[model samples]
Target: MAGPTILSSPSPPSEEAGTILLETERLIIRRYFLSDAPAMAETGNDTLVTANLRAGFPSPYRLSDAEAFLSTACKPDGTAYPQHNGIFVKPLTADNPSPEPRFIGAVGIIPKGDVYFRTWELGYWLGSASWGKGYATEAIGPFVRWCFDTWPGLNRIEGEAYGSNEASQKVMKKCGFIEEGTRRGAAEKLGVLKDVVNFGLLRSDLEGVKELVRDS
Candidate 1:
């Protein structure tokens, strides 16, 4: 008899502790929670946002999907196996605080094993309302650096941006990811054949980048 088809497991969190909130000068990248589900669903369900992404995200996203995602990404032990983080803008002042942190987007690093075990696949998305602010660039750079710093064995990180996604390609470029090449018809989105541009950053390339300092 054939064995059951099982989903692959994510890599364990490294011995070096992971942070709940990674602060850059302008943004905070943190873990997703059930509380953020409504915002997440709203951001993801936008036609403008979903147009560039894979087909799995339904047009009218449900709260149940968000809950499932939060549970999967954040386990009960408080350790995120696959390492998904939410992007939020920092408030301008210490005294005057925003009621809720604006949900700019989410990013993740998926580790693969093979000849490519040392490589992780990177993916991200930004809400339509958050466009044009350079938040994507700011948030991704530190996240990439943190990933390499935490996992010494990781040599390369790669991502694919659909040809039409100039904003995402710009983020990749700003974060020091070099354009490797293009894969023809690598994905199908919204009934259209999309060409994806491949980008990668090596550990050596990230060596000169400064490590992010934790905020109190």
Candidate 2:
């Protein structure tokens, strides 16, 4: 059960290549880089990881898949797509010190338009090896706050999990997302129909929430 000493950052760090969006005790959530394709492919190529994620994530994820995703997340000149990020394992210890940030997962929001312009959808996925460490729970809170702070017009953020994904549901609960309802048989994954459970957090829900660190 190794961990980092600093559990929260009032101000997140920044770098030229990737802007550090948020930091927690053991994770660094930042914009993805094209070079991350290899690591992304390696870590995301698990059936379990893809099973819990959206249909877009391919099983046996290859370098090509990772490349396409990176291409979509950022432009050739390195400008980020604005909301996607890679979740890296922060190396805060000297023994395991490595200059490179270890890519472990990702988190992002899909902007809604038209009548739902003020709303957004939240999604995240971690490598199977990184599961059960509370990293998802730790990262989501501040990320949500950052979203509210970054977009003043943003009123609500929505998260949906397959009914079978209890772990994801728990993470949403821990992050102050209120369970809205279940959309029965709304999604089909791997040829099986699954209920989608909806959860939401409004800007008003952030009244007492704190500890969001954004780069200047």
What is the number of backbone collisions in each predicted candidate, taken in the order shown? 0, 0
lDDT accuracy of residue 93 in candidate 1: 44
TM-score of each: 0.81, 0.84
CA lDDT for candidate 2 = 0.77
**Residue pairs that clash (backbone atoms under 3 angstroms), model 1:** none
lDDT of 2 by residue, 1-216 (tens): 533222122333342447777677677888878898999999999999899887778887999999998886765332122367898877744412777778888898876766786788999998888888777887788788877776566789999999999999988877878899999999999999999999999988777444332211
Cα lDDT tens digits for candidate 1, 1-216 = 653222232443432322354678777777776677887887877889888777776766678887778766665433333467788776654521776566778888776665677788998889888888677777788888777766667788999889999888988877888899999998888778889999999988765444421211
Regions of candidate 2 where Cα sits further than 4 Å from its true position: 1-17, 76-81, 94-96, 208-216
Deviation (Å) of 164 in candidate 1: 1.0
Model 1 clash count equals: 0
Q: Give lDDT per model, in order.
A: 0.73, 0.77
lDDT of 1: 0.73
